[model samples]
Target: MTNPADVKVAVVGAGGKMGTRVSNNFAKSDYQASYVETSPAAAERVKDAGRELTDLETAVSGADVIVLAVPDIALGPVTETIAPMLQQGSIVITLDPAAAYAGLLKTIDGVAYLCAHPCHPSVFLERTSPEQWADTFGGQAAPQEVVAARQSGTDAQQALGDEVIRCMYGPVIDVHWVTVKQLAQLEPTLVETVGCMVGQFLKDVMDHAINEVGIPEPAVKAIFYGHVYIALTNALRGSNPFSDACLLAMDYGREAVIKDDWARIWDDEDLDRVLAKMLRLEKIER
Candidate 1:
């Protein structure tokens, strides 16, 4: 068994908002924090947080786990650069596996490459309006309540819903795992079939409400207008930042919904129930 206190962790891209949050969280942990950031300002932030700011190559030295928090599209190339630098048995996991260059994540004989996404729903909740942020994460919406709800759910047929939820730093409302096969099939279809569809969804929703059929653009804007403000409520209410892997999953989910294509990419029953529950919660909050 590994001792949590003895574990050494490295965080790449430690300068951005998500990076800073992760770095800060690790700084306050019993584990040592080795920070790496391309931005000079991020390097200064690492020093200010009282952590060791090391070059990317040195940061992963002797570490048990390496967290790649870079943009989804850039992960593969970066991993290719660092694969030779890691020790055997090290685990390299990304916050979002959906968009990662999974093919580029070469594994040395003994290393474990796990692509994971964060389950925290509250992180997005933080990007909401200030007036309601307090109550959204306050007394009634405590972490314990979210945890309890998450415990009863399942992401894949292979694991308990609670076990999935428990792997996160904050509340993870739901998750959809992707296999290598699934990623290969879905990637080709995304650009033409999915991305444009999403843009159309946004535009169509706007066109309708401006006059009669759809919800008014003003009202739709108001909803997401609170997104930035409410995103913080998730963590404050006890949810952590949405993991990179989870964000990728959301990208896929949005694509799937827009294309009406739900097959091996995700589990339908689980997703529908989860979405319904989320909508219910939104209605209650509203």
Candidate 2:
């Protein structure tokens, strides 16, 4: 295993959202770390946080693990520019799997590519502190699991990558390993397309209750939030059986709000279609 103190880590987009979060963790870790940001505002954030910024070429050349924290749309060009400059056996980490799964990232023979995405703090977590409760996104005070994929690497290489992954997203529960394609499917398909869309739809419904139905905002929120927890626990964990009337209402909801063909989003063609749109490519070659 590579010693954490001996590892050299570079965060390429250290000023952005995920970049800042991971950078905060890395800055406090034992690894030799460099913050690299090109955006003016982002670079200032890095500077304000008391970290010296390194030039792109210098950081890439020296890093044992390079985190490409740039946006998905910028990944192709960014990797094309830096992949060749990476040291032999160095690991390049991406925060998302979209570009990697879509075959948009540039690759080199000796370097490894990894994608690790946070599973955000679980709703069921027993967070006792104010800080933990406030940290819904994880990494600061709340513990979160991560899902990761390695495109090319030996077990030893992967261990080193995992060490970095845990540190950058520390207070981590566990790192779940999956193939790049599987990670992609779990993300945009199951999580975003279905889960997040449903969450947003819930918000819309709440708004309709307050605005159109003229329910008191506080009363609506109080009832909705408690029921959200009950719904999740009852449906997902089988904590308690839902009431008979609730089941009837749920059946009505499924008929009214969901399409019978919604499961088709898990199909390979659908995955490819979503990935193409995500990566801004006309089609996925494979």
Candidate 3:
């Protein structure tokens, strides 16, 4: 395993969103880090953050780990450009699994590829500080979990990837290792498709309640926010038995709002279909 403090790390899109976050963490760590950005505005952000920017070739060459923190659409070309220059046994990490799972990354025979996505602090995480409570996205003050996939690597290479994953997305609690396909399924399929969609739908319902039903905005927010917490706890954890009336209402709501075939989204074909749309591909190739 690579020593965390001695590893040479490079951030390819150091001026972007995920890039900035991971770069900030690395800046505060002991690892030797290089920040590379192509955009003028983003390059300014990186320099303004007190990070010295390096050229792509200079940053990637001989690096122990190279992080492609660019957008999913650019990952293919970015990897194609940089993968061949990497040192042997070096790990290339992406912040998301979509590009890797959809066969969008350029692979090198001796170079390892890994993808790690932050689980973003759970809603149920118990917090003791204002900072933790305010850091809803994790990687700042709150502790969070990470789901990662090592597409090509030995156990030691995987360990090195995990070590860097923890540093980049630090204050981390655990790292759950899974296959690239499994990671993709948990992301766009389970989380974005169902979980995030439901969260937004609830917001739309609340807006409708206030605007169309003429409910007072303050009163609607008060009840809806509290009920959202209760609903999640009861449904997810069975924290307490829900009342019979509540259960009956839930059943009615589910029947009215959800199709019986919604579970098909979990199927392998459906996963590929959604992933294709996400990656802007005609179809995923194996």
Whichever of 1 and 2 has more TM-score, that candidate is 2
TM, every model: 0.52, 0.98, 0.98
Q: Model 2 scores what on Cα lDDT?
A: 0.93
Clashing pairs in 2: none
Ranked by lDDT from best down, the candidates are 3, 2, 1
The TM-score between candidate 1 and the true structure equals 0.52
Candidate 2, residue 186: the lDDT equals 94
Question: For residues 1-286, could you state the per-residue lDDT of candidate 2 as single tens digits?
Answer: 6678999999999999999999999988899999899999999999999999999999999999999999998999999999768999999999999899888889898888999999999999999999999999999999999999998877777889999999999889999999998999999999998899999999999999999999999999999999999999998899999999999999999999999998999999999898889888899985
**How accurate locally, in lDDT, is each candidate?**
0.53, 0.93, 0.93
For candidate 1, write residues 148-259 as lDDT tens digits.
Answer: 2111112331232223222223333444545643432343234223444655766665566666665667776787546534544653454557778857987897786644
Q: Count the backbone clashes (under 3 Å) in each candidate.
A: 28, 0, 0
**Model 3 TM-score on a 0 to 1 scale:** 0.98
RMSD of 1: 13.7
Task: Give the runs in model 1 whose Cα sits over 4 Å from its true position.
Answer: 48-50, 98-102, 122-168, 171-286
Question: Judged by lDDT against the true structure, how good is candidate 1?
Answer: 0.53
